[model samples]
Target chain A: MGIKINVERTSAPKEKPEISQLGFGKFFTDHMFIMDYDSGEGWHHPRIVPYQQILMDPAAKVFHYGQTVFEGMKAYKTPDGRILMFRPYKNLQRLNRSNTRLSIPSLDEGLVMEALKQLIKVDEDWIPSELGTSLYIRPFVIATQATLGVSPSEKYHFMIILSPVGSYYEEGINPVSIYVESEYVRAVTGGVGNAKTGGNYAAGLKAQQEATEKGYSQVLWLDGVHRKYIEEVGSMNVFFKIGNKVVTPALNGSILEGVTRDSVIRVLRHWNIEVEEKTISIDELVAAYRSGTLEEAFGTGTAAVISPIGELNWQGDKLSLNGGRTGPLASKVYDFLTGVQRGTVEDPFGWIEKV
Target chain B: MGIKINVERTSAPKEKPEISQLGFGKFFTDHMFIMDYDSGEGWHHPRIVPYQQILMDPAAKVFHYGQTVFEGMKAYKTPDGRILMFRPYKNLQRLNRSNTRLSIPSLDEGLVMEALKQLIKVDEDWIPSELGTSLYIRPFVIATQATLGVSPSEKYHFMIILSPVGSYYEEGINPVSIYVESEYVRAVTGGVGNAKTGGNYAAGLKAQQEATEKGYSQVLWLDGVHRKYIEEVGSMNVFFKIGNKVVTPALNGSILEGVTRDSVIRVLRHWNIEVEEKTISIDELVAAYRSGTLEEAFGTGTAAVISPIGELNWQGDKLSLNGGRTGPLASKVYDFLTGVQRGTVEDPFGWIEKV
Candidate 1:
């Protein structure tokens, strides 16, 4: 990378929160990375500065048009004091992919990688070595143009914020119940569903709130067009095991191409478990449950690498899965992923990058 | 109203721009209305402050989750020196409707109306009295909670910013060519399409940019599920006069319930012209175009009011209407609507509210 990044250390660093008290996305580290993008000048003046508030115009495009994109990743501290990140370059690639769909300018991945490693190095003391704790990294871009027109913004701000966190869920590793959503549609095949943008999450909040009020942990989304095929599980890639076969929805234009989903499939194949990616419908799943073939269901994402779904409530039919317990396969996959992330297990696929 | 609103006037006012140079949304007035909403206190601290930038945390929910809603209205400086707003109470009601969809807290519309009137009084000098000039008011609410959760934020900021503007288009009231977009989808039936939210506009920017590159003024969006029924024309409700009948897309839980759209239908029916609000497919319009019954097509919204569709290019087959000029029905509707807005015609529907 030929770019020069200016680093400004914090004069008065705040005390780090207790590891046990650190929930998700609440406590930020001392340092963060930021850069600005102008229409003609491109991305310039990359800097690692103290964590602070952002002052933007009241009429910024992001506040009005919701033109933004983001990526979620984590960094873990090993017992021997080694720091590791799982497949960060892939996340940068996905971030650029999302930026393209949102009409924001694409960032130089290599240069941003340099900036990220530097920021993490400056804030390395903030990494907690607790069993389930890691430094959650959020890299996002927002439109900064102070214009009200609906076109693409001429200005943008790219930022990376680090938050020390425990598990994403209060339930931790326990399997949770899911509600099969029928009335609300998340994204269509021709929309921005595949892209990890703000709108997709915003669209899912109502459904999630409704399901939570009904005592479900999350809502499983169906396809926007047919409303039959399974698309995702509460912003995560979903998988089901039926009749000794592991199945997940294919990388249709509407569902997100989850990074953890790919890793899980690769690991399962390495262990001689065949994984099939195709259209999965609720009716087919219900029939599988009736035939005693629906063994285990889990969701895969960066926040919760493997969320074992113990039950699914589809149209008032509560189908308890794996006897309301975490399946053996789900536990094995979670252990392998977390071990690789924490550098306890051997890196089989070269997914871990040293910081 | 039992609430108190503090007012703070700016000491040094910036020089106003020339009315001729006051393009759409490019110039802001001196003062703006602001209110804050906390989870426990609800909406409070209403004030009129000088126009300035907003200081927000980098992890504000609006930036990452797009949990926001907005409404657009304008205040016209009538020839009789009275400031008038067209159906502003209706706009406030619609704002609350959008808020409910986005899961934000409902606002007191009556209190907000009082604030709007006060804000207009303080910045009344910025309201341009030139031909085709008025003050554009943008009322919006953005999630301000400094957390990275996918759920709704605990805090919000409701704001009203005014911009003195000229006509929306440099083309004035001339007819524009529209490209029928068949690839990208704006929204779906079960989604936030009916709400006046930011995500809907963000999802359509790419198509609009592509259409502009192809020499079209805007893109005509079809429904997401079928991709054949006409949904909207560049964020505006569309209408077509064919075979002595005026047809617009019905509010099918997908298209927006536009204020201008309702006004156009009422005016048409009030003048004894038959108007129908039903599902109008692209094939039906094309068939009407082939049989020489597609007399006029125009879009209705606050910005453009009445943008006549002179030509429609559907898959390289350009269908010219009214010989690529404004049709009689479109002209009549535009004239009558603008006349009532400017207090030039009788207020038959009582759609105007004097400030």
Candidate 2:
């Protein structure tokens, strides 16, 4: 299918924010990509328009039934003045999986890839040149059918917006505290857990808020059934180094397949380190801590890349890892991942897609 | 808090649809209610405006995180031309519950009640006078914060829209078939299943679509963890008559507290019928069916009131209930509920609130 591209540039562009003070998702570029999908017409009318409000009927299914899915990746400005995207095709593949689970129509991968590159090229100046900052790209699809029924929508809108974001942490590569959630669940097997959808994130806000109240930066969710086996963190996939092995919760149908997680595993394997993907229960982690074998724990995602976990509080029992400091393995992984993202390291995995 | 009311009437009134042809949630009334909520400022500027499209930023949290909740109810037109809302306060209370679970600010029940009544009075003519037809009122709240983070939104918009809808079943109250879903799970005990939010419905669309393709009217969801305990029917709560007792799923954390389900339980108790709310697994239901004690099965919700189940297909085995006809108990309950709603029968439960 041929995608006829149309461009309508914005006449009055807004002033850019200070690169030093820019926080995550606080500002957007001048242009965005949008395409519509009718039940019979398929996806059509791909265009780049000014970043502005979207007008939709009040009875759209997204507002009532939450028929939507989304993917998050970033565009990096390398030291050599080149723009790169880490594993762009993986994000699109994950997006298609999400669409299938949410009953949304699939997109043409080739067309979407072309659209992404074009949109980024148009707003290329929006890419941050700072050491730790990048342009966060959010691609989402919403059910736009104007009806008040509990069914799959026949109309949809797929949009891509660009936001110039600063580093996730103000202080680079620092250790943060995480609260082990014993009550609320993020996802369960046989549900939409593996899909990068809005509903799964929406269901986690209350627990996240509670963790924030308790002075924890994030919540480490456990499985919905047993509430003992560890699941991924609400924002990223989790990893723990016990003894000589690194273990992450397996992709048990409920854990999201993070692009960063896959990259980290590949890097570890390339370095001849043992990385196991299996179920790691909270009890086993606590036991490891007791046995003095829990060397390092961290989370992996596109936003922060690698966030070290300094302390874990589970049911009021606090366990400090690496004396509440960043461990050697955690720091090494962080430096290596950021180096690969910024094009300072050799491209062994062919992860970077140049724009 | 003083809620300043404002109203704007539409200059171009829409042509009214034929009452006989009015389907569910297709035609809207002339006006709608809207309010805004910020982090520090509580819900404010409660007003009724002309029904129109809502314009939102592309990066709004609701479009990406599914941060939305909605309530459904109806306004009935009595023979004397008076409008009555059945248990409207219950819906508001339930909406507040959903808000809390979604981390949205709590709504002032008293203020919301006044707003609902005022909006209904303004669009009183939109209420259908035909038998089994009424005006469907939908109240929803959405996170309007323009951010690209997976966190709770600090800004929100609360709105209410009305649609004149005919009876759910055009051919009268007939029994429908249900497919017992064993592969896809809707909600688990530790998740946000109890809240009437959009995510739970979004997660069930795939299963519902598959069931529809298999000649089933709806998918009967099982518990997310066990995948055997009967949970709900996605759009409504399920009930089964075994031997001499009525059994519905208990108020587990994963089951929605439906208003219709509550009213039916109360009415059954008033009639001196044994009503039990507990876990009724599919295996137990199948055993009851084999023993010839399955008697009846039905679903309860605001849309259909009571939808009798004529057959249930679990895996590859199909069991017919009441010989593919509506049962005596189901018919009696439907007539009594409709009669109470239309003001033809004395409402011993004081469920109707006049507008």
Candidate 3:
């Protein structure tokens, strides 16, 4: 259940790049952490190897069958220069949940945590100090067995790579316009929707591209059954505010149970706000928006804690909420979440893990 | 658009194995074909390298984004001892169609054919001589750029591998019972439903596993909107015989335009059978089955020429079709397709292409 590390080091970057100029997932650190697992041998050969090419056969299961899963989280740099990683164990648990759905082997959480700590410990300088900027951590597992049959692979590889990233909203936190896709479905029941797997993102890419083409920021995918109920956005869980109640789509096995989403629920509950998890249909939301009762809407994820949604275009009908900007509840939630991450607020839940 | 080959040959197998004992996608030949493409330099450095592991960055885009596509076709040994591939150009066209959906660059069909010819000439001994056995060819393209971003990849790699395969049905073309999955959707309209990409197959694997768990061979997916219209079975196109009409689902974007499906349509039309492509819902199929008008039901694909469906279990109700064996229409269609593929019958449509 534990990892075995074989350590290797690399020279740091010669020129420390500016955090503001950093793009998403382009530049990597000097080293990466890796672990391998087979059916017979559980987990072995954990190492902090130099960031380099990994040799794999063309027929490897990941290439053909897409039996791969990944997690996205960030390590924050506090004002006092102390680095903190937010709830890494939650990410590892979600990774295992994704593994069960894809039929890939799962490694122990302690092993993954140790691997992340080792990598971060070795490459701490890569963490950005900007207000919204931090070191983006990507941990992924892939099926590596060289076979071409349409089944899961017996051998797997898990690796973690770090990249310095700036704020996702470069133009400040303005509410965005999203397209409601009624014709396309991202994930369905009994599918790998709840799992943060590559297929879910892959299925949403075309629709997302369509949204981009149609002059929207992202796509809001509806359920496959009736194309009426709201499921989720492309990579984030959705939350809607109508009057005083905050409602979201229930965890119906087809929508990813985002870590940020769960945290928002806990934080809102702590604040004594009425939070409800139930079936939220598009028709009802449209009616609420038309009646001027839908206070605000936003998306939650690790990349951006809260992205306010000000407009939605569902099948050629346009609707706006809160006058195309952040609403009262959205601002409060964003401030609270970011404040906790940046160590500006009280830490009652101990959500931040100091390294 | 063109490939430049650098041939590096490896020693052949110690001894040629019997073709009858060959399995599917397990054994490979000595040398494999490789090619590379970039936006700045286009395609360059094509090679017949040894079948080996591909060294790639752990954060490669293919692993994270599932931006991958593949084509599956086979090369056959003629009775005259000359090796030929069936519909190679069709595979190339389908590969490009897949590329358009994945936003990857397309390779020239002529270059692909030439490279495949050179590789087949080198590994001619790997082609099985048995009646139902042949050399299975897999050509795949993957995003190889070392980035973790969500946008399209700037660099890609295309490679081809060959494996000797026996019959797809081990029990000698036994009719299989299928489960109609109403809750799960494989592909939807305006999605990558028609592309030969990794995401579609990944989505189907879960349904396939569920069918297997429920004592069925495969799961039949319905239309995403209504969940009542019959779309397809896992990895195959569906066909039904109601009275004198040979009804199949239309070529909707949510359904793959299978090459075998096209051939069957052409053959049925040529034979003057009342073949129609329209939406066939589950309720209509159930009514037909009950009224004794559902003469036969079968699934068509490249793996199994035409597999008969004995029973369909929809929502816990098992509806038996024509007994648990091959029907007259299925046998005729199977014989016609196999004969054309084996070069034993006249190919009036000129669908078969010689390597």
Residue-level lDDT tens digits of model 1 in A1-355? 6779999999999999997788789889998899999998999889999999989988898989999999999999999999999999989999999888888889999998888889999999999998989999999999999878778999999999999988878898899999999999999988999998888888888899899999998999999888999999998999998977899999988899999999999999999998999999889999999999999999999988899999999999999999999999999999999999999999999999999
Report chain B TM per candidate.
Answer: 0.99, 0.98, 0.95
What lDDT would candidate 2 get against the real structure? 0.91
Give the per-residue lDDT of model 3 (tens digit) for B1-355.
3446678888645355576666667777887899999999887788897788788988788899898999888887878887766677888999998888777888988888888988888888778777777788899998888877676678899999988888665554668899999766777776677888887777777677778889898889998767788999878899999999999999988798888888888899999998999999999999999899998899988777688998899889988887777888998988887777777778788776676
C-alpha RMSD over true interface residues, each candidate: 0.8, 0.8, 2.0
Evaluated on chain A only, model 3 obtains a TM-score of: 0.97
Question: Best by DockQ, which number?
Answer: 2
Model 3 chain B weakest lDDT span, ten residues long: B12-21
lDDT of 2 by residue, B83-162 (tens): 98999999999999999999999999898888899999999988887878889999999999998777889899999999
Predicted complexes: DockQ each: 0.83, 0.85, 0.56
Which pairs of residues have clashing backbones in candidate 3? A54-B56, A56-B54
Tens-digit lDDT string for candidate 3 (A1-355): 2456778987644366776578677788888988888989887889998787788988888899888999999898888988888878888999998887777777788878888888998889888887777899999988888877776678888999999887565445678899999876887775677888776776777777778899898889898767788999768899999988999999998899899999999999999999999999999999998888898999998987899998999889988878888988989989888888878787778899987
Off by over 4 Å in 1: none
TM-score of candidate 2 on Cα atoms, chains taken together: 0.98
TM-scores, each model vs. reference: 0.99, 0.98, 0.91
> Worst lDDT window (10 residues) for model 1 chain B?
B127-136
Tell me which of candidates 1 and 2 scores higher on DockQ. 2
True contacts kept of 2: 0.81
TM-score of chain A of each: 0.99, 0.98, 0.97
How many angstroms is residue B215 displaced in model 2 relative to the true structure, after the best TM-score fit? Answer: 0.8
